[model samples]
Target: MLLFDLDNTLFPFRQYWEEANRTTFTSSPLTNGLSYDAFLPLLKMFDEELWPLHVKEAITLNELRVERFIRTMHALGRSVNKEQSQHYFEAFMENLLSSITMDEELRDFLDKLQQSYTLAILTNGKEKEQWRKIIQLNLTSVIPFEHIFISEDIGYDKPDPRAFQHVLKTLNVEARSATYIGDSWTHDIQGSIGVGMNAIWITPRQASSINENLHLSRTIYDIEPCLFHLNRTTTIT
Candidate 1:
């Protein structure tokens, strides 16, 4: 079994999310030509106030983005009427969809991996946003649509064993037979390893430090090179 993480693993999350947020904020009438630096104070105020509500709901990144904007406007002493907030949220999401770009060589790597392993997506996020990213990135064409799993759909998020168990049960594979690839050490690596699944840390940004307990099978700076190595190793063995 081959499982993938959706956000920063298959697609670059930081670049896409930042660009999408900037576009959404600048395009909105709420900003009113305010510089991002000037507007940031309000955004921070909103985050401080609204983040607790999000944590209660397990706070998917997409939802947090919208909430941040909504609360920011409110913090600036501007009334974000329900209708306006809804409009901004929708527009923000649309911009996010437009910003998605798959990592280079990801499609070809998935194509090859799919032939030898049952491939699936294991992601933690709001169902709609995660699915939107999947579709926008054109991942549905590479991996089977039925194999995708979202935290919102399952009522549990990564770093939770139930999430991994859901995929294991769906694929009818033992934990030992499966391998998970992701960028997050806590969410993807530790989460999968906790459930006895092999975990590979895809550390493209060098953001995380290696943990001894996670038992990571490998680390790769990029997916294409890793896939090529895997193919060659499989052929040699």
Candidate 2:
């Protein structure tokens, strides 16, 4: 079984995020007089700062979504009411979701992988938005609906051993029989490793130390070599 992360692993999430922000902010009157460049950093900073709190259930998803934009506008010397903040957020999300489309190369790669493995998605996000992204990416054509697991639905987020263990139990697979591929080292890699599953780290960041399972992929398209490495390791073991 092959478990995958939705955002950065399945698609270029950071690229999509930047493009979406640029498109939305540049076109929207809501951002008038605010430099998109300046607003973007503040938006990202607050998101990074507040995301852990969201994951820990310290705040509601709606609060996290609206607060980031509110803080960004405040930093830019603008005030926004809740309605305005929500309007801006919805606009940005629509732009972001609309920008997702599966290219032929990715579709083809997933098609081939589906032939040999039971592919599934394990992601951390609100259920509705995540489903919207899945539909936008056209992932249902390749990955089955039931195989997709959201942390919101599971009640346990990534980096938690229980989440991985739940997937393994539900799938009736031993930990050793599963392999997880994702970009986040703390969440995806460590979570799967904690539960004794094999992991492929899909990252561009330089590793502080080298190890057999730590494969730095430039893109998800580069995953073939990492899978090959895993196969070799399995055979040798």
| Number of clashing pairs per prediction, in order | 0, 0
RMSD of each: 4.4, 2.5
lDDT of 1 by residue, 77-100 (tens): 676665676688788678988777
User: lDDT scores for all predictions?
Assistant: 0.72, 0.83
| Tens digits of lDDT, candidate 2, 12-78 | 8889889988988998887887787798889989999998898788998899989999888899998
Instruction: For candidate 2, report its TM-score.
Output: 0.90
Q: After superposition, how far is residue 205 of candidate 1 from its true place, in Å?
A: 6.6
Q: With candidate 2 superimposed using the best TM-score fit, by how many Å does residue 187's alpha carbon deviate from the native?
A: 0.9
Worst 10 residues of 2 by lDDT: 206-215
List candidate 2 stretches off by more than 4 Å. 205-209, 212-214, 235-237
- Which one is best on lDDT? 2
